[model samples]
Target chain A: MAAIMAKPSLKTLKCTQCGGAIELRGGHNVRSIVCQYCGSCLDSKDQFKLIHKFLNQKRPFMPLKIGASGKLKGILFTVIGVLQYEEREAGEFFRWLEYLLFSPTHGYVWLCFEDGHWVMMHEVKDLPETQVEIVSPRKTRFKARDKTFKVFENAQAHISYVEGELTWQAKQNEKILYLDAVCPPYMYSIEMRGSEQEFFWGEYISVKDINAGFRIESFEPATVFSCQPFVVSPLFEALSKGALIASVITLVMYFLISSSGTPVMQHHFGNQLFADGETSKEFKVDKPGSLYGITVHTPNLKNAWSFFDVRVVDRDETNKLFTMPTTLSFYDGYEDGEYWSEGDTEVVSYFRIPEAGEFKLAVDGEGGTGEEPAEGFSLSGVNVSIREGVRLGHYTLTWFVLCLLAAAPYFVKYMLFEQSRWHDDEEDDD
Target chain B: MAVMLTCPSCGNQITQITRSPQVLVCPACNTTSFLQNGRLEDVGKSAILTDIPSIFQINRTYRHKDWKFSPVGRVRYDYGDGWWDEWYVRGENGKESWVSVDEGEIAIEVLVQEGLNVPPFEKLSVGGVLMINRQRMTIIEKNRCTMIGAQGELPFKVIPNETYDYVDLLGPKRSSFTIEYQAGGVECYKGVWVDPFEIAEA
Candidate 1:
């Protein structure tokens, strides 16, 4: 048997919709062919049928260079074929390419050299549409406690670098046109260059633009950067201690009022009565009338008499010697003997005490039959004593004192060491 | 060997006929005839006209091995000295195919074989003469029928009488040609156009 080697199929078809060509198969199979240029597809068999025929004719080749220009988002751009260049070239071309690929939408044109490298850029106009306005550079000085430093004018707007050690003479053309880098730490410096000074500084300068145009006028250190220790004064400390003492006294008064109990006073008095027989009954005091008075006094006296008064009556009534009724009389004064008279009803009242206190009444009667003179009656004298009110305890006072003591140190330190308006002025000086 | 023939009705002269035992029909009276012993004899009225002429010819001899034209496609080949040869062929499927030739003979033969089918004639090159009738087309080279076209418009057709000023054949000389239906008249003629790549059997 002979082996039959099959040849690869060479007959191909072209897409009707998008002008792209493809290879065909047995019995004109209906397969989709997509145009590479426009991405249109021929899905149906009728659509894939070719209207024009092309013979597989062989021809020669030609070399040509072509370019295309188009607009994207209103920005005109030109795309060139591949470019070729040497490796050593300083990649300005590559930078231009990167700018084109990543830059914001702007009109750009690209060039392709024969070496297959590419360069793309926006066309450079005579002047930039936007420009920077620079004010004239000036010089200034800063002081921190004892340390002095010079800050060039316009330094706040930009960064400043020192051309040399702190010097009296100012450098020329202090303005900084561009900032390249910034160096840190205590000596804070900036690296900058200007178009006018480009030749003087060359490519870049370590320190060139600081303290350039204006006079230093005066040099001083900045207090914020100072590291000096602070000390407190004695007068302020004493004033703070006095404030704490006043606070302690006020706290003690508050505690005393809150802790003590209410105040009260007591007094007692007694009296006895007797009846006479025969013509007249006479009463006499066994103990002399000492005039015992119980008086209760406070800041307001009207409330003291509510508990002071007492009412008394005789219990025994005996023989006809009581034919004469006993009369009671009251005396207002001891010297003048002004008396209160009872008419038919035989009760007498003499005086009232302003405060609650015990008082005694003396009584005497005329005897009608004159027997043995009436037996004498007597009343006992009252007793009274003054007592102190209950007091609040001492621990409350001690706690108040302790609270004041606890706050004293912080108060003293704040008064003496904290910075004030006057201290800010002092810090501003070198 | 070749045969010379005279038209039976018009007595017009014809020569260099092939020994392939083929028939010819005269353009004057439409006489059906065959070549015998270096002369032409008329067959009876039952004989009918059969061969036609081709206006365009393939100038190369060999055909490409891989060349195939389905429909509308174009191919190009590079010749030496920066010249290009191109071919476009229209197919029955209403598709076109193009092939290009370059400096090498093997590449040219491959392109030719892919583009054209086998000619039912013989030994035809550039500068050959063609005879046409209602039925068949024939190619005469050196006054002999070196190639023949089958009757009835062959499976594929060419635009007739369309001449090309091939740079290789004439060395920068220009030419004009036209294509027409045999019964009607010439359709269109193009003057001084570059020669097209040759077609051959695959």
Candidate 2:
């Protein structure tokens, strides 16, 4: 689809209308030349005959003048002409520019710039695909990359300025209604005049790349395009893949470490009571292990929660080294107005011991309506179960959390893709 | 090359000579002769045109697509605000084709014959597709520019400034298409984008 262009040659032709010095530098193949002085369009083959008189407007971005050379896809090209276009809707005026590029070998291409973003496009001989579904009253559906893109912009674009040689009869003030279907950096455009339509396809070019092609060192695009894939895009992709891989790795590690958990104890201390400040039970550890598990169960409280403050401590260590107290609450609430509840009436806690020793499983003495738990709410039949092993449930829960975090990058990617669809287009539900 | 013919207006033998000059000036009577139907028909008085800078010179051959084209003649059109060039190129096979360079694009063009039916500009639209020679193509741009004048040699007749309407179509591969509405009803043309580098001296 791409090839080298013809070598450029310069021949001087004076403008017939203005006698202004005119230069035709694209190649002898150039058909038309515009005068810089008197603004005359003339045939490049012979003496300049007045095709039309034109008043040149200032080139929009003057640095990109005619005859400027650049490389696209590593192929050299010369800017043979520049045309500026403007349009208006809803009392707001929008403008852009298209630079005609000539590749003596490849023939011709166009560089379009709007709000500082540039797109290199050419007439596509092959149409991508079309859809039968009508997107809007005035627009149709186009297919690209297995996705359907709706016509987002359809407006009349007018020529604003022109300079250098053109292959077609390009005149300022000529306007054509063009429809655009955009999928981020790539856009499919159609220009309709009368009964004929033309198709052109293009991709967004970063300012950095454009500058490098044109060899412009001091340059920055007017506005950074939102659809312009960020340099960190690849980084996000790498991280997303890494996150998924890490999630799986973490899950496997979770299962492996959790497999080492051996149930050291599962004794349920049942119907325990504390008449004093705190009633405690002593469990002697024959061997110490990596982790501890505590499960407390209470009698169903109809629709109430019973709270118990429990602690595990090594009696051998006077400093109460393992005396970490934790609150265990049990609830068995019935479905009620304004809210519904369904949960187990049991809770769990864990403690780790450094060495084998005698440890005390202690429960606080009841104070709030302490006797018989004041009727409806009670902790009298409360049972406490303890186990010593690696905490498998902790690893499983942690693995799930890590997986959720890992999925975040993909969501971000999706949102960014959606945002790019609307970046240069006016909002439309269609 | 100058073609000798009798001026119908001045009734004088005149010579229309120039390198592919489409509109020839009869030096004997100042009669403007246009090449039409294998004859130089006098249209009006001739206007002396100034020479302007062009990339290609006469007698120089350049390559475009599979054809080697040496620009022989050219026409310029004015669309009110600006003007562009359309060149007549003679190929190695002795086939004549038009290549238009406008706003920096080069397209190989040919005259569409008469009697071809074309929808009105109001009815057709951009992003719309049309069937040509049984192949589907997309319409990208519609143009309306008036022919102002021409120079050098040409295959068809030309008026100094005749306005016409047309549309640009694109094929699937890399072909350029154009349909023009002129006095001859409709004309269809197929063209392809050409690069200078790909084109070489023939």
Candidate 3:
């Protein structure tokens, strides 16, 4: 309905049908005005010409009457009209109320009341015609908004009652068809009339906000609308946002701290040749630790893989046992017109060593073949290099898993919100 | 614009195509008369039109979904509450259709030709659905409406105060079908709903 901002006129006209006093608090622009006493639809433009004498006053529940003033967005607006609409689906009737509010400066806007939730809306004149029904391929776009909206409710609604001044001739029980899409706190609606279509942009308002805006003592509806913005639980939104930021900060910290790590000790066994099950001289460790990385480099191995199973025993009186298994494989061969090579000749294993001390190194080789002794490809004969330090990969992997665990809840929450909005158009796959 | 006729009472002449049994309220003197057999028979009636704000008016040019239309006539239906206006229009491709506007909704209706087998009116229920012409359409409402007024060229005569019962059905892609039951015959109309804002911008 098109309404304009006009200065308030003190002129009050008697309803031609009922002689009831009528005031133009909505402004001179309102075309149809209903007599509050007799419920006569009058043509406000043409001397309050009687349009229809409405009977069957099964009035829908409305807490406020026409001409009630409310302040919206700090602007004072007077209620000009009220309309009750009901949509029937699946053997049930869903009803909602709409109040037409007029600010002498802001013209007219609608305050929709349904399921105890309120939405304020204004007429929208243009939208891509192609967006008739949820834009099929693109589910979330409404007009020019960056967020995509899901279908809130799509049903045919009918006007059940009208009161006071309205932009159009107020109907008693006229049918209206509309499709509502929500990006919550915002809703985009397309209404269909005979051959004319209209658009409305709606914003979800809290009951508290409504009461404050209207300066009402309280407005507490018994039931909540299924499409209420907070139905998804705002707690989930806060949790997801907070967790996402925390994960990013933790990731940065992990990268910085992990990169600055240095090896605590290093050992070279290049000069000493060792055989299988051979134990080397004890390397004294100045510090005792929980976990250490045992790195071994067996140089120049070919055509096979070599694995060493190691046992770590503390040299102290109480020799607690800790063991780690490492693999070093280097394979090169030519067959079937293609040359293939695989497996690194060096490997590292990180494990707990009870406590650091005089740690002895043992070399046990298995499954090494097809190479000369000089090439160091045979088992039981290769150099070993050991580095005992904080394992960056181990701690980094632990933090990465922790990050994933933290993100899982947020991901599920996003899907749940989408599920609630998509409840109408889609059946849950689950 | 079609055939020109003189208002029997006021002698005002205007181009119009009157359906066989409709009353014409003289655009000049507001004299209402029944047009029967190429002659105006005085019925002595007039209507005080509630000013309806609409961009799609009589003889106005507009485009809807690739088809250009020129509104020729209108028939307003009174369903006890308010008026529902169905504008008789012709497409650029020479197809005659009805465009209805009530509240802010805009939908076009094209008369379904032969070959559709629809059940009797009594068999249709508000919540019941049926497959018509291979499209699944759900019945929304069934109403009995009377002719309130009309203007200009029309395909069917605007019988003064004639009542008809119709059922409204909705289908996929915003397509809706109307099953109108009349005394002599039944007329079936189907069309897709459109957004007025989409076309207003176009």
Candidate 4:
């Protein structure tokens, strides 16, 4: 339902049906003018004859009134007419407002408001060239004014209401098939009625800009529109780039700072040392204070257990002892006619060398074969190997993990924005 | 040489600005007269046009970019939906052109000479295609406009309330053409759309 109001006449004329003063702003070009006060459609060309009258029509929400002037694209335009169209697709009803704007030199332009989004449109005489893909036949492309647009929507829209002065005689429920194509921030609409086809090109305008142009209050957008472009702030862009660069630099520096560890000590001892209950060895740590790895292997110890206490002393007369307690166990027997082994035969551990000097390593051990080692149990042989300056992986991993954590939120939001833009297409895929 | 004639309706002396024009409307009494057999003939009275907001005026020199012309005559046509004005102007080089003003749209057109094949008006339809002067054009609008009034001196005779059919064709790059069907066969005019903001008083 549409109720219109017009004021301030260029040529003051009275409506024949309702005797209401109708103002004509489009000069002689206006074919029909509706009585704003009485809802009577009057012929503007033939002495304001009564064509028809709208009865009990509800007035829809309109932001701009007829005869209201606003500046658009550097030209002053007046709202002379408005048409409300409703599109019913798949049982869903969609309504939009179209305001016909008039400028003395620029002719006419339409501003369409839908779902709190505004689009400024102009009827284009030049039609776009269309191409259909051989693969994926549902995808249609239109090329116009050097921009390619993909088909976004296809539906039929009907004129629900008409108001004010119009160039042509408009009636209720006039159906027209429309095809919409989008190229981001711009869209092309092809409307067909019988044999007459009209092309309209439109550009998406921000609510802030539209409000400022009309000097009206702000209109909040209900949701993201199809043609609404994703805008990234400069700070966000800089931070994203900086994080990526920092991660790469940290990885490269970690590799440059690490190396393979050098061998420092190797020795083999017989079970006689364990039988004596103690052993000691002096080794030179030639490198500066760094991490060192020590490995102990007992190849010949079978079905036996051993407990040992090891210490590293500075050998500087301070006799500072570093205690390391270790347990080695191995057992094998036939279970269900299959052989199985338990416990480990080798163990490795890491320690930091305090300084580059001589260090004395001492070990004392007890061994057993079955339950009590005091009864009778002995180890065969043992091997000890140590290496200096080994690389640690956690340093590089920590920096990489931190960078990923910092960027996850922004990346997820961007992905969601793109997914929302193609939400209709994704639903079709499902 | 300029020939001065007296208006048959008002008996006022009127001078012919250009020798090619056979019709001239009296500025004083709004009476239309035609030159025939070296004598002025009364052709009834022309309607006094209402003053609408317009950018160009009769007898005023207007400059559009590099081209300068002064409107010597005007004809108003009522084409159902709206009325458009055709200003007959004489260029600075003494040539003539037609400037059409429809609402805010303005175009500078010149008469295309005969010898080019033109299609009949009856077969023309809106959005139809046409080949005129070796250029592919599309028929944008077809209108049967009635000449409501005329003022000043025109190059051709203009009859009051004379209805004629014309088709407007648009070519590539804003090139426009109009084919008018009259009692004497058909006439074509070719031109380009002009920016109204660039037009200034010379």
Candidate 5:
């Protein structure tokens, strides 16, 4: 086994004036000693030198106890801690919170609730005394819940004045302190402070004077708790769910309404040609008056014509509303060299009924017997039914049927081919 | 070349008439000076004076135990006759000094410890040289003089040389003393140096 080496003992030096001993470690030689107890300066030869005397100067290794309480976003919180620090070469106290809070990982977002609204803020920088500027759109007031408690910000935690006793300890002459507290996220802001001007987030209160001997101080509460954690209620959840359902329903209705077809009425009157020499027998439907309840039958002619022209004129020749000319066409019809030997023929066209009136109907050789000649010879058929114009019930029924027909394919796709499992997860989470 | 000494009272140049003269009378001032044995007489009138140039150079490596402890501190003084100098020391516990001569030509150097207490010296005096060891302080006072080695001394002057059987003086404690150099003329002062290592341990 290899032999273990013993560690060298550190040389300890004492100040002549104050009897303070500063231990030098690692066997390093020191040329001077400053008494932390009396602030006296000593040379290597034991000579006393009167250097500059510090007045109202805080000890670099002093521990400060701070107490602060305030309301943030409707929640009241309190903080109590002992801050440890030292003097920089520039004679400024190097405060820890001033540097730690502003670190990228340490920076916090504060949300304060007041006046029925939540105010968010980020800490800017700290100034001396009990003041700090928030990097928010406006300034916010930070006050303790009780008048007896003191609230401070932007002040040096280690050097700020304190009304109570505090204690601290560190490794051998090294400085250390203790802190304890609970604070709300909203009341906090980030700021740059300390001798090096680093950033930190927190409020300041009292600074305790911990003499050189101790390591830990007694813990105490800074302020009373006044608020509880905020929890969202189920009422809000229900209202939000209702709003979402309403929106979805409205969107679906709009899609269905926009995709539905319009109502149309078509009439047939003439013959259809399949082959050049092969012509379909003429077929026609003619009705007098409003023609709302008339039905006409024709011989089954394959390749039959599906178009018809209707004219409605008043007795004084003023062009009656129900006697206006109308054209009709159909979807299922004869192809070239084929005849529409059909049962119920489908018709598609536009028609309008202007007013209540009687109308005469006639078909002759694919053209109606009228002053305006028809292009093809029209079929002959005549019938009459008295009433107003086309029935509103019929138009409504047709629109309903068309809508059902159009939605059939989409319903099948959604149920089988595009079925999603997302709905189940949403339901389970809810 | 022959060595000559100038008489301070009459400003006349004088030379040794013999190597064993007990006393030499100054012809210009009619002053008589006695020599101890054959060695040059220690008249006690000619104080070891350091010029502003030499003092400033030497002080660059001078570290004290107390005042201006940190090298980041600033030092400024006027060496009389409108000659002002400012110095900025860098690094921790280091020593540096500067002088403004005719508004140009500044000299600077770092002070490094050779052993425990001895510090290296550069640009000391006017063409004179100095070398300090941990156990001795040596000075080549002039170009022609033999190197005077003050041996067996402590880094600091706590006890007189005669008290200890085998004692060495280390370097002076930098924090104890504060030195200000001015230049109406040159003057040298001596004082006791102390050892801070002893005082701190005590």
Candidate 6:
């Protein structure tokens, strides 16, 4: 329960310990006020009597001073108190500053600043759904309100310093166990001290918003925080979507337009007798600048090799339009007590027809066996075939590569960002 | 209808502003009195209430969002750590309600007398859950509050310096439920938390 004084009046009282003037801003609800001058903790209910003297009280780095009023989300809150906490584990120390904000309407809220990050937290009464199951020794999972949370840290924290007014008597060096669970941009925390446990829900506040709310330009976070949500750029999102749409369109076009070309020429040559050359009958290329598919096959060549220097000649036989060179070979034997084979007996290639006109196939090549001919085995001949207006498979392969190239950078960046957020979980697991 | 009564101690005319108020403090002499069977009975001097800055005053109307009510009387209670005030207010519709102010938080509540199954105060603890009128509510605070003072006119009897145990439960959307265990009987109030900043003098 909270005490209401919609219009809070300042009560100035002299400190019993040091006689320094102390200002109380929390109305009757303030139980303790620390003298900023002499570091004396006084009981506000008992004539400001000295409860404890916090000696050597050095002020930590604070951006918001006491009695400073600022409006957050259209509600005005005054910075009434500050509590600095420290946690020590594995010979490492972590410190944070918590500013107690009081709104005449919203009761109490906390703004925590740690490592250049800020979170605004409000105490809640409803318990999370799953409190009995522990995901691991250091982590847990629960659902509260509407969000699912993954426990980020469970550690014991100690109060290192206190200033301004507090609702309860906050002692120096008090220790309490706190657990923090996060669902990006929001965090659920539980603090346990003896028989009392308090729950607080928090939201990550960006530096820009904090600066605007408090009217101070402070800092930028250099590391990922527990509740910092990953924001995707609109440009990147549009680019990724565009790439996907392009891929689908390319696939549909490939399936709709792809076809094997009409046969134009076919030729066969005798074994070891085509050293001069061979020519095919005349054929007409109907479409100008269309694609042509050429295939060379050595049907009777076993454990032997063949090479072909092919060219497309005009009907007048004066000028050659294209030159395509290819080799076909087949070999097999037992090596190291294992059978092995290399090279292919047939090969295919593609070329663009220069113009729509009459043409003829000119082929010249050589054939021979690598070793002495096996018993009753001999090389026979070579077969050559050509077709015009063909669509090759490499067209789809090229489009696929282009699509992947467009989206890979943003994908890698997103993955790295997610990894950085959970980087500390690996160490905790270990 | 308004009934006029005379203060026993001050000999001053006291106008009973509302029909349901049982207790009235004389503005002239600060004498606390209660009406029984249409006659004023003296209950001695009213407890001294210290002057503090507050949002509400007796006989003043305040508006919160769309609600319009005038605070007719007040009862102050002292608990552990701090004190709070329960202002008995009458809305424009002639329905009575309570505006509880504690540590800058305010709750506008109405007395609930039917279909409530409240357990004993000793069985309740902070952070415990309770089902009231089929709605799940969480008990946020349990404390014994002592009646310290009274002012103006109140609907219920005010026993000066009498202490009673009470538990406050919170429900969804800032709903508040309070169960007060008094010596006479158990009383319950159901309401919603109102933002103090939204309250304005009407």
Which portions of model 1 show Cα errors greater than 4 Å? Answer: A1-257, A263-391, A419-430, B1-202
The pairs that clash in candidate 6 are: A2-B102, A2-B103, A3-B102, A3-B103, A3-B104, A4-B102, A4-B103, A4-B104
Q: What are the per-residue Cα lDDT tens digits for candidate 5 across B1-202?
A: 4346554455556664222334433444433345444333323221111122212231123333433311211122222222222233332333232221112212232222232322222233332222333222323121211111111101111111111111111123211111212123221212223221111110
Native contacts, share recovered per candidate: 0.00, 0.14, 0.00, 0.24, 0.00, 0.18
Assess each prediction's global lDDT (C-alpha) against the native: 0.28, 0.64, 0.67, 0.77, 0.29, 0.80
lDDT of 5 by residue, A1-430 (tens): 1111223343465655556664432101122333445644344322434332222434333222222333332222222222234334336544432110111111222222221222233332222223433332222243322112112122223332111111111111232221111133223333333212322233322112111111235243232221211223566545444554554554555554442122122244334321111111222223333224333333332234433333333434444344223232222446796855333332222233334443333322232334354455433332222222343344444544555545444445434421231233235558
lDDT of 4 by residue, B73-186 (tens): 888898877678898999999899999988667878999987667777888898899887688998988989999878778878898888999999888766889988988878
lDDT of 4 by residue, A187-301 (tens): 8888887656777778888888778888888678868776776667878867876777777777787788765578777777666657664444667787767788777788876
DockQ of each: 0.01, 0.07, 0.01, 0.13, 0.01, 0.14
> Against the true structure, what is each candidate's TM-score?
0.14, 0.54, 0.48, 0.58, 0.18, 0.65
Worst 10 residues of 1 chain B by lDDT: B145-154
Better of 2 and 5 by DockQ: 2
Best by lDDT: 6
Pick by TM-score: which candidate is best? Answer: 6
Per-residue error for A35 in candidate 1, Å, reads: 71
**Model 5 regions more than 4 Å off:** A1-188, A194-232, A257-260, A263-430, B1-202
lDDT of 1 by residue, A1-430 (tens): 1111123343555556555564432111123333333433344344454322212212212111222333322233323221111121234331111111111112122221112212122221111112212232222233321233232212212211111101111122133342111011112122234432210001110111111111111222233221112324667656556657766776767665542332122333332222321111222222232222222222121111111222211223222111112332222223457543321211212222233222222222222113333334322322222222334445556766676776678675554543431264345553
- Relative to the real complex, the DockQ score for model 2 comes to 0.07
Question: By descending TM-score, how would the candidates be arranged?
Answer: 6, 4, 2, 3, 5, 1
**TM-score head-to-head 1 vs 2, winner:** 2
Enumerate clash totals for all models, in the order shown: 85, 71, 17, 0, 45, 8
Model 3 earns a TM-score of 0.48
Off by over 4 Å in 4: A1-9, A132-139, A232-415, B1-80, B85-101, B104-114, B120-129, B133-136, B144-165, B171-175, B180-187, B191-202
Give the lDDT of residue B140 in candidate 6: 81
Task: Give per-residue CA lDDT, model 2, range B25-91, as digits (tens).
Answer: 4444645677665567777753333244344544478865567778766667765545567887777
